[model samples]
Target: MNMNESFQTLNFLPRGKFKVELVPGVSKTNFLSICYGALTTIGLLTFISYSTNYVLLENLAYERSQIGTIVGNLQVIAEIVLLSIFLPIGLIADKIGRRQVYSFGMLTMGLAYFLYPLATGIAELTVYRVIYAIGMGTATGMLGTVTADYPQNHTRGKMIAVTGILNATGVIIVSLFFARLPKTFADMGFDQITAGKYSMWIVAATCVITAVVVALGLQKGTPTEEQKKIPYLKQIKAGLAEGRKPRIQLVYASAFVARADLVIIGTFLVLWGTMAGKDMGMTTAEAQSAARIVFVTSSMSALVASPIIGYLIDKVDRIKAVSFCMAIAAAGYLSMFFINDVLSPDVKPLFVLLGVGHQCAFFAATTLLGQEAPKMKRGAIVGVFNLAGAAGILISTGIGGKIYDVIGPYAPFVLIGFCNIAVSLFAIYVSKTSPDVKEA
Candidate 1:
């Protein structure tokens, strides 16, 4: 279907009301799958981004620099765990079905979250983080591949944007309700550890609920007859062979940068903002609130930007579109350099800019991968896609954590900003040299 028709028929909005529309040719089955995917995305991302970043990690280490290092280490370890299992899980999903792998990951996550509050120190926390990473490894790989499975090529970006919206909404919901729940418990005279654990248990419950929904609601697709004929090893070899192409190379590059964007922001941004608030004489509760505001502002901005960016992805060249988004992200991260206080009004614009920029890059990259990778081998390709992302998280956060402590609070952002600019230029070069762009 055409873009205009896709928009008009996707939803049943009254007159000019703003509401999300379904993509064209969406069956009741496809619609249910999308809805369940959104719901699952909401639960998982909320736990990963909001509950953990905004709430749990902050209290783990008292020293600001120590917290930075610890958070960085957590990411490093988790990504390593994710990297180890991602390819195998992808292969398994392709061999059997995505639904089982996807739902099983959620179950792993729920178990990990339940253990999070039980940790007595950094070492125990690291163990829990690894468990969570295992879940993340399996679930995230499937989520991307399955999402690509559902959308028509023309509407892939829009479908991704809808999930992005759900992700943002998840962040907002957890930020508003769960991020503050610990503080609420503290206000009621609970001890710090108790208050935090209670909040985490709530997230754990959500994970369980989401897992059940996914296991029941998500459907398995019949592999194409051609796909059925290929050996698993041949599929793996083909997926790796595609990596030598310039477009696939670019997508890998995008994965490295894009995966770390939110992680750095979610983990360190909270660390900086909360520490800054404490420096300004705010209590722990107040500081956390300030950090939540930062998280919420960025999420809300991304929420607003997702659909618009999705539309742009449909109309523009994916390479050029990603380059533009990277440019915006670079500008946003660079602007943060000038803000002396994390809570300053000056930071909101930067948050919005970063949000829009990052989300755009995210969808553009996903859409490109969806377009470029053959359907039969998509799960394997997406496995590699996530491996690159995991590596990005590992390298950037590992160095960024140290950078946060050694160079300055703004150092990590500065480093990533430069990387974004460099990548943006690389994308332009690819656009100039690459032909048959639509195939990618």
Candidate 2:
């Protein structure tokens, strides 16, 4: 459909009210947005991605990394804080309208970044981190929902991949930016952490600008208070039901479990690398770098893989496709145990395989969610999918952290790989049992 037709037929709005305004798609605002959106994306990523830095540079990798005792707890608490408000924030979006609240998320995450340098102790850092994470949570929850608002699936996978690329690019930004901070702080006669504080300032400034740009660029139909007040759970439940074609269920099961592996790696990889280094003979920086490499590579691949995966889903049996991708991811995680035993000196190259597997699985799973979701209720289905993914992060970061401390560092990935593979097998079994497993 043409852009005008897409706007007019958007069933989420009143039939007569959805108008296609003939306006410049890229205004003076797009020029500003290019910069601001990158910044906002960066700021949100720093808090989420910096944990890897902390893992490599400090507690997990080095004995000096004192934040470990509290880091996992802080992450868990903050994610809870984020997730606790998810369904409600979604309700709030429907009630107050998406642009205003989503813009606030951009602003919220930027503002949240400002607190990173204030860490006097673990307690203070954790509290501040929780606040920062909540802001990112809002962006995380809303971005895809907003993007797919009009439902153009042919390129939808590409858009989703772009989101992941932007997100990973943000990680690279923080990584590169922080990599230079110690030198910058030294030049300015300040401490490293003090200089790092300015990163958030940059992030926050960008968010404010993006919020304004979004306010100007796109037009959404205004909802009457009556339309806005549509009962939250009822609509969400209906959307879930509407979206549950033969394909969506398989996607959810595969995606949720596959995502759990990510949750584990994000939380424990650096810590595990660091722990192994004591005997394996490596430095803290090297260990953390090991983990960071895994994340960067895995995330970067999504930009290329996501859209292709999306196209594949539309053409093939989505259940089998997603199942195969997840099985590969499981093997990636399982292969890690061999790294220390075999590679011993360093194990970064092994991650190329891991990255490929993870990208395929993650994008395939997410692509399926997009395929199965109804045009009218994309928000609710996306919310639930993210919620399930978030649940995986919660379990992995919280419980995984504890396990890393107590059970031996390899414990988390081993568990994640086993669970992922087992689940993929279960999904495949389920797919075979349900003959009609295809998207609407």
Candidate 3:
């Protein structure tokens, strides 16, 4: 059968109103698989931050004071690895296929997880983290590339919103269930070490299964005739040159702060809550559970707000939408200064705000990038975008971790908050001076 016939056969699939007008050759089946991949890949990646703390305290016997520095260093290492390879990975995806790269990434993550629980020291753990970073950069790079590839220009914001909702859902499920597995096993009469090992093994298995799904479910081969005709190095140069556009510069800036926001919440927020729970005389398992509650609150808020933010993105000038999103993010992250206790019920509202802001900023950045990136050079352009994000992670985690240990846990959030405000102002400037040209 022809591609049209295959798509017609799958027409009964439901993707809601927002998913209308897919680009040619992208069926509802491909869209569904993309959504599921979003759910699992991000869910598993975010859970790593939460679970790493458990391993440090329970399995490695690290002190609370040292944990911040160690986690920071580990993230720095991962980002460094990502910095080196994100562009090449994107070029490879453009040449071979997104599914092959994406599938291999998932399988690599599974390998890292299988080795994670077997670490006897920080050195071993650090090595495993580098392996994990390779998978993360590969999978997430494809995620961004495909997200941009699947939709017509008009439906871009809604597609991003759907994926954003699934991303939040993944985080919630992983935090609530997968993150809690170690504690559950401990409660079931396993030792701390054994529980952590078993939990990681289960996640490792899940990653392998997800790899299989991605390999089979996603659309096969390169995306466009134009891409195939271009020489490889010229594609790289074209992607880099596109950054000269003011709107593209704004998207890159948004990516920097937006990525940092995610890592801060995943790393510092949970660490703060976990430490607070321990101070109250809770066991490591109990403390982790409490931290997960706070983490879940933020993810739940993101889930609720995604469709609304997405709708607004589709309706407004995307640059203006980015400014609005950064404004909300500024408000949320700056609000962290007011919270004296992360574990208190009164702080739930603040966490909710953080969630909404985080989701909005990410959706805004991604949607804007989707709108601006050229179709033929989309993968390479997305790599640069992710490279900017990697730089953000490097700085935020490298410095934020130190300040989190020295100044206060609230310091990291406040630092990124000011960044959000700065980007918001920049977005406003770009909107006035360099508005997007109307698409023909």
Candidate 4:
């Protein structure tokens, strides 16, 4: 059967609002499958972020005073693993099909989850995390690459917006329901350790299921048409050389802070709230549930703002859009300094602001990359973009964790807040000096 004949047009949204224009050979089926993949993959990742603290506290019996450092170290280790593999994975994705790489990543994550709860010590858990890092780096790298691959330049923002909405939806569902699974199981008469294990296993099963869905539903074969013509080494060099452009440099910068913004929220926000809950005499599971409420508040706000941000990105110069996003991110992260209690209802509005900021930064960076990256080298370029992100995670988490223990939970938020402001300033300068070349 002809591949193009087998695929269908995208009809997921109204033509008037979305104005989607898929690249040649991409079908509605491919787009929708990508959307579903976005929903599950991010949901699974968020669940892991929220649930890790529980594993440490409930299963491993790690000291609360030390958790900040431990989680930080674990993330640093993961980032190290990711840093080594991200570029190669991108190069490989260009060589193979996105579906095969993506499916393998999901399966690897499943294996990590299955091993996570079984860890009797931090050492064993670190080994499992290295596995998780490889999977995470691959899946997330493709998510960015494929997102860039599927949409036409004119409609790229809207496409990104759609996926962003799905990403937030995944985070919300996982945060609201799946994050509470350990607590839910405990309420069902299971002990803390047993409850934690069962909850993780359930997530593991979902990872396996998601792997199957991605393998079957996504468009198959290498996205690069010139794969055979271009020498492999030249492809890598071409991807790197694009960084000579000031705008791509800005994209790389945006990616750095953008990823840090995400990790800070995912790793620290919940940890902050959970520790606060414990201080208030709550159980580990109860503390985690309380933390998720705040986390969900941010995700919910991001969900509501997605379409608006997407439309805005498509209408303006993407570099300008990035500046606007970073300004918002700066505001949101800096606001943490004023909040004394993360678990307080009064603080929900601040979280709402934070969520919007996060969504904007992510959307801006991705849409800009999608717009600027050459089609033939998209995978490798996106890989380098993700490498910037991995570096951000390594530095931010590595230091954020230590200060989280020494100074306060708010310290990490403040640190990244300043970084966002720096990028926003850089974007503003780039817009004036080296505006994006208008797409032909």
> Over all chains combined, what TM-score does candidate 4 have?
0.96
Between candidates 1 and 2, the one scoring higher on TM-score is 1
> Which regions of candidate 2 are displaced past 4 Å?
1-43, 49-69, 187-189, 206-210, 222-229, 239-248, 258-263, 270-295, 301-311, 341-346, 435-440
How well does candidate 2 match the true structure, expressed as C-alpha RMSD?
A: 6.7
Candidate 3 has a TM-score of: 0.96
Name the candidate, 1 or 3, with the larger TM-score value: 3
Error of 3 at 370 (Å): 0.4
Weakest lDDT window of 10 consecutive positions for candidate 2: 17-26
lDDT of 4 by residue, 166-227 (tens): 99999998898888988999999999888888888888888898888878877788875677
By lDDT rank, best first, the candidates go 3, 4, 1, 2
State which candidate has the highest TM-score.
4
Query: Candidate 1: where is the Cα deviation over 4 Å?
Result: 1-9, 12-26, 39-43, 46-61, 225-229, 438-440
Give lDDT tens digits, candidate 1, residues 73-129: 878999899888877787778777777888888888888888887876778878888
Shift of residue 20 alpha carbon in model 1, Å: 11
Q: For candidate 2, lDDT tens digit of each residue in 161-249?
A: 54445555665554445434434554677543444456446656666776776556533532234546567777678656854554566
RMSD of each: 3.4, 6.7, 2.7, 2.5
Candidate 3 per-residue lDDT over residues 1-440, each given as its tens digit? 12245452222235444443577788767877888899899889887886689889987999989988888899999999999989999999998889999999999999998899888999999999999999989999988888888878887888788789899999999989988887899999999888888988899899888888888888888897557677879989998998998988998999999988999999999899999999999988889888999999999999999988988899999999999999999999999999999999999999999999999999999999988888887888899999999999999999998998898999999999999999999999999999855341
Our model 4 lands, by Cα RMSD against the true structure, at 2.5
Reference-based lDDT, each prediction: 0.75, 0.56, 0.88, 0.88
